[model samples]
Target: MKLTAISALVVLSKVISIAAHGGVTSWTVGGTTYPGWQPYMAPAGQKTAGRPYSSYDPILNPVAASLHCNNDGNNGPIPQSITIAAGSSITAHWAQWTHMEGPVTVYMASCGAPTCDSVRSSGLQWFKINEAGLLSGTVYKGSWANGQVLNSLEWTATIPASLRPGAYLIRFELLALHQANTPQFYPECANLIVTGSGNAFPSSSFLKPIPGAWTANDPGVLIDIYSEAAKSMTSYPIPGPPVWSECRTLKPLSERC
Candidate 1:
């Protein structure tokens, strides 16, 4: 009986660990819903905007190629792109999210090609469009951007009103800080065909690469959010370049930004 109970406990622990992480399952644009890639299931060959990833597990290496999306996003089977007017809003629906201490960011990169299906994310230049971090309270126990996402199970980002029309890749990211010693990044990408007559594009200075934007020792990436020093910090330096000036103004999430 004792041995059986021990085995049962081990099995339950494994199940709990597996359920602790999650990934985006679908996206909504202009009242229409599109499915996201499923890591565990074979490709359904459906027309979707979301890109395929390897799993729901978080990417621990800041400089890994996987940082561009999650995993296998660059090489996986490409899904059909969705068309949306510039300045529209798109929402990502997660399978589940339990971590709360983190920032939520949205980035975009024009494919400069006829189709984004063949474009490699590494060669593209990315620019931040929206970001949210430590919204209230101290870093140790603040109302964070991920907390908002966790509460709603969804996160919405608006396309820049002045963005140029073209094929683009939109990246959605959440940086979980519960384990400050090792920051966790949950990133996903989707293909989009933005339609508009506007001709605004980010300058060279504003464009940043995924793995190049963050370093392992960056202050925001390596800080201890639960430490005594963090308790007194009212603001956090969200890791990444500033949002493009041509983009819409973000509602103040923190004074630091």
Candidate 2:
């Protein structure tokens, strides 16, 4: 149980990420079209609980946020956006849903807070979502989205080392839904932990767990993330020059849990 902040690893480049993070979006997956499926959860009922949903919600932390059903891309705050050093590799892995028990489709893009309509290259990565075991049909195998695009689920791109930091959001739009009418789905919002080059946390080496998988109901599991534990940089200060314009991204549900 250790908290790891990827940004706080070491101050090197520019600053980015400035917006409020509501909290994480959650999901429990199930489908048969694919071999073993990833975990997916859409808003199951008519109404959603809204913010203040998770005690550890990033919105409360301000540096992060989350959205669910009725979650239109009409300009929502971003949670867990941070700065990065040059030449850093940012990666992620996810699964999408077309229907409850069918294939899932997910699209990705790189945009800032005020306007997140910017579309970046996306991955065709596929993962099983049909009530599969846990991970890719293995233990700890559940992931959101349904494809085999590795870069899609996991992103590993290098920051320009001279890129600027600002408001950004990783839009997770659902191509399919369990029901047709409501254009909303579940969320497992990711918590971004800053890390310096070579996974270094220079500040005080403090590791604090930021709970991501908790719901309004259910027991809680915690994973500690170490940021600039000490007052190294300003609260969510922007990263320096040479940045990964769209590289600022997220983590997995199981790892957070």
Candidate 3:
């Protein structure tokens, strides 16, 4: 006899409760790997492009300023920016991920300043680049985009080919819905100097503020994955605005992580 999807999810939740939550340990940009900020370690002099965060703890409140990155992601010592061309791929390598359900999304915000060091996360306007939620199956029995990330220990996103060259903050996010009543948000940011000649940029309509992008009442954030209603659904509504048109044209939802 096999356990039902609901029962399986309950068991998974129990495991997640005891397991350590994780964050991005490093990032691979254009085949080069850069270390991510580790809260436990002392600040080594500008060794990485990733912003510093306080810990691996997940952000439970979507309205918190920390949701833009992670805890202290905007206040810590700013690391140097990494150079990468538009249309390239960047992969985030997580320390560990045991959660089996939810979506993995990526967003980009222009730093506006000469370097990202001077900019605060609260002031930037972000636009989605990639988002992958439930790909197929029921909420409990279906295959999820996060499942792929869990198996690989890494998630990748592509920069828009037509994006203008400038300083930007690339954010990597994992929303674990194992306990959907209170979603777990794990987000990290990396400084980037995008090099390219293309001039396409997201318009005002495409830009969304981090804390404002999500709410507790959003269908995706408040869902119960193990419920009968969720099992009958065919699609999952990914939180936040749609992906930028330029990025969507370059990589459709089917191709994104």
Ranked candidates, highest TM-score first: 1, 3, 2
Q: Residue by residue across 117-229, what tens digits does model 3's lDDT show? A: 87777777999999999989988679998899889999989888899999999999999999857898989999899999988888787799988997879999988898878
Candidate 2 lDDT over 198-233, as tens digits, reads 321111111111121123221111111122331232
lDDT of every model, 2 decimals: 0.84, 0.23, 0.84
Deviation in Å, model 2, residue 142 alpha carbon: 21
Q: Candidate 2: which stretches are off by over 4 Å?
A: 1-83, 93-145, 149-162, 166-175, 186-257
TM-score of each: 0.89, 0.23, 0.86
Cα miss at 162, model 1 (Å)?
A: 0.7
Scanning candidate 3 in windows of ten residues, the lowest lDDT window is 70-79
Q: Measured by C-alpha RMSD in angstroms, how accurate is candidate 3?
A: 8.3
**lDDT for 103 (candidate 3):** 92
Worst 10 residues of 2 by lDDT: 124-133
Clashes (backbone N, CA, C under 3 Å), per candidate, total 0, 97, 0
Q: Candidates 2 and 3: which is better by TM-score?
A: 3
lDDT measured at residue 10 in model 1 versus the true structure, 0 to 100? 95
